[model samples]
Target: MNPLALSIAVGDYDRTRPLASGAVRIDGVDPLMIFLTPEEIFFRAFRSQDFDVCELSLSSYCVKMANGDSPYVGMPAFLSRAFRHNGLYVRTDRIKTPQDLKGKKVGVPEYQITANVWARAMLEEDYGVKPSDIRWVRGGVSQPGRPERVAVSLPADIHIEDAPEGTTISSLLAAGEIDGFMAQKVPALGPGGHPHVGRLFADPAETAKDYFSRTGLFPIMHLLGVRRTLVDKHPWLPTALLKAFTAAKELAVGALTETGTNKATLPFIEQSLEQARALMGNDFWPYGVDANRKTLDAFLHHHHAQGLSKRRLSVDELFHPSTYETFKS
Candidate 1:
């Protein structure tokens, strides 16, 4: 029989596509139900109610609320890795340092529940500049004649209207249309292509190390969560899925390495590996039991201190009960 239907909300399905098309026939898994983005999974979880299990980031307050003794519960995974929120890219001719960002307009997609918050935190903690220090702008995937809109919350800031995917943002930076923007390095077009624009942050590796040293909290970029009802009804679901995904991630790592380096995709793959190592160590186990608890506890304590949450939610309550027991042994 085919494996049960499961869904994950993340980037393109390149890694899993091959498995889905193969004859391996994932036991109790359904390849057709996978989702590519968190937004799609969120809407479907609430609307269609079709999915038996879903993946959500641990940092997301929405997932926390949804699992608050409700119908859904979170199954935290230590093996899962966090990706860096690629830093602000700017025109090399304009801004030289984070200090120069004062009064300049910066663009971000989601202000609140995004890697932007962590990126901003790093800037403030390291550079002593608060959010009020810069002109902020909000952009999205929808805009007239453009794939996204440029919406400014601050006054007198130049509007960096939506540009097409590859050339637009780079061109804007090159032409001085917008001061800077944040994006993943995967699709990064180096200064070679856009002459004037270059990365502002010097070394992401050192920055991440410093952030962890100071805060002892690693920001979670993605989380694999299992639904509560499913866990309660079928105790084996969480472990089974965890094992499957862990295996899949290993396969992905191998596939990535075998593909070698292409100018276009090398940066993304390298950065992803870096992130994976930071979050899960070199072993790349996507479902580590002990690591998840440590990371989750640290995150909850930090948020609680910031007055983000009232009290600490127990890991047992958040994750599958079986997971807790499995970790204890």
Candidate 2:
């Protein structure tokens, strides 16, 4: 038998580095990894429909994919610590409270992804600000001249573009290039909070809980999705992939805990724990079928409200229930 191949997509972040590492550890082969901006991932996926399986931010991707009229199936849940999408930060000096963001510029790489959308929703829902109230700027892959990339039905003003990742956004924030930005929570804080920067929203664990409570949505930080036809052809592929990833999550968690206080990887481990608490609450389970379904339903409803999709995506259309059942049973 040939070694099974799976293609995975994810943000270029250090925390997610374990996914690649775990792939090698388990399969003895490196999964096909595509590193790109969130926007590029969506465009590439929609245009070419390439790759047997791909990972993506769950909420935003669901909106875009469903809007494009593609019938792609997403994993029932995020891969453990991989689902923490509630990290949004801003310069503490500029935007002290969420309400202070009025007329200010907030940067995000892509709006179609959950980070931006959920952040916006939180500001509006929690803080009581209209999405159009802020000055949306698009920061491209580079720091200098990226403008906002607008979504189909989103308010025209609710978009901005900036440097590709949080590192650049962090730099821009430190230098006063941009007011605020959203990124992974653990990485948002460094030794002394970036000198010139202050955090506006640093409670990813809290945000995750609040999101689940308010919207019944578990913001998917990363997802493993297969093309519909490939799923139909290879029924076992999804199960095998999920099993490998779930095992990877466990190993990653164990490795982090065992290496506690090592100084080198302690921060990463701590951050992972924060994310785990957020996603799974006190008792964390990497694979929780009930929670996963609830999240899916929330995501579908959000997309529908935004007018991104005309119809609600059924659980069957979005995930392989059998995969979860097989794993649990």
Candidate 3:
């Protein structure tokens, strides 16, 4: 019989492209890949369980898992990772330093989003700023009144307010209504053409590199997940999918290492590759529990501390047991 066909939705990341392009194949499954924006994937995946397999926001995933209502089980194939310092934007005249954010108004697309969680973690852990220090305003980055996908009851000390009915964080920043914004994508109008909007870190790339040099955390943002019912019905599917994703990542790394010409559109692909290698060694982006335990643990700690996760989850609980071991080649 032909393998089961599963619909998988995720970003069109280079590391995941091999699977999408059919260069890598699951052992007992036929994946129908749909490339969508993270927002679309996360909302549909979490709110409606729209796909059989999808990339899930690590923070939101934990929330559902902690609530004992998780519809999906994790596969250790992290599809997205990055240091979030670059995602922190602020009004140039109002918020100059991380310390300056104290007692200021900070905007987020969603308070429970993984990127915001990590960015807040960096602020409190590195600087003296606590999550409660700033009054958090939750809203759409470009639109208004975006609701948190998962239900979360925050700690008593943290203060989060909803944005006004018809205004966005970009508009708030442009008008100086909010002091800063932390999001995976900076608000559209708050940068580029706007003089008042700028990143909190002057040279965000350099700052991210410096932070990584000290912490050794690439900051995973998303992981692949399979609907729990599907996993229950097809017990072998998780392991098979994990194997395919690992192979796809290997292919992506090989593509990055080619120096004949630029593999990506960026002008500094070669230089960036060299820098990454120097800092993180050859296999910078890794899969599996052992390779990402530190980062995972840190994120879990923050997720619980920020009240996104009802319970602190161990790294072992985050992934399916089937993905723990791979067969010998």
Q: Which regions of candidate 2 are displaced past 4 Å?
A: 1-47, 80-94, 141-151, 155-178, 183-197, 202-218, 256-264, 267-285, 306-316, 327-329
Per-residue lDDT of 1-329 in model 1, one digit per residue for the tens? Answer: 54556554444454444445552334465655454566555445544544566655454543345345334555554323443534667667888988788778765554444355455655666787656677645444232132211111322322333354543443445567667766433224444557666667767666666666665555665555666766766677776665555556556656665536542355577677677677546755435546556655655554443333446555454566555444322
TM accuracy, model 2: 0.68
Q: Which of candidates 1 and 3 reaches a greater TM-score?
A: 3
Ranking by TM-score: 3, 2, 1
RMSD in Å for all candidates? 6.7, 5.7, 1.2
What lDDT is reached at residue 269 by model 2? 65
TM-score of 3: 0.97
lDDT of 2 at 247: 66
lDDT of 3 by residue, 1-329 (tens): 89899999989988888888788988878889999999999999988999999999999999998898999999999999888999998999887789999999999998998888899899998997999999999889898878998889999999989999899987888889999989999687833558888899999889888889899889999999999999889899999999999999998888877878767877878888898999999889899989899999999999998888888889999899989999997
Q: Give the whole-model CA lDDT for all candidates, comma-separated.
A: 0.53, 0.58, 0.90
Largest TM-score belongs to which candidate?
A: 3
Better of 1 and 2 by TM-score: 2
Clashing pairs in 1: 3-28, 3-29, 4-28, 4-29, 4-30, 79-285, 79-286
Q: How far does residue 24 in candidate 1 sit from its true spot (Å)? A: 6.8
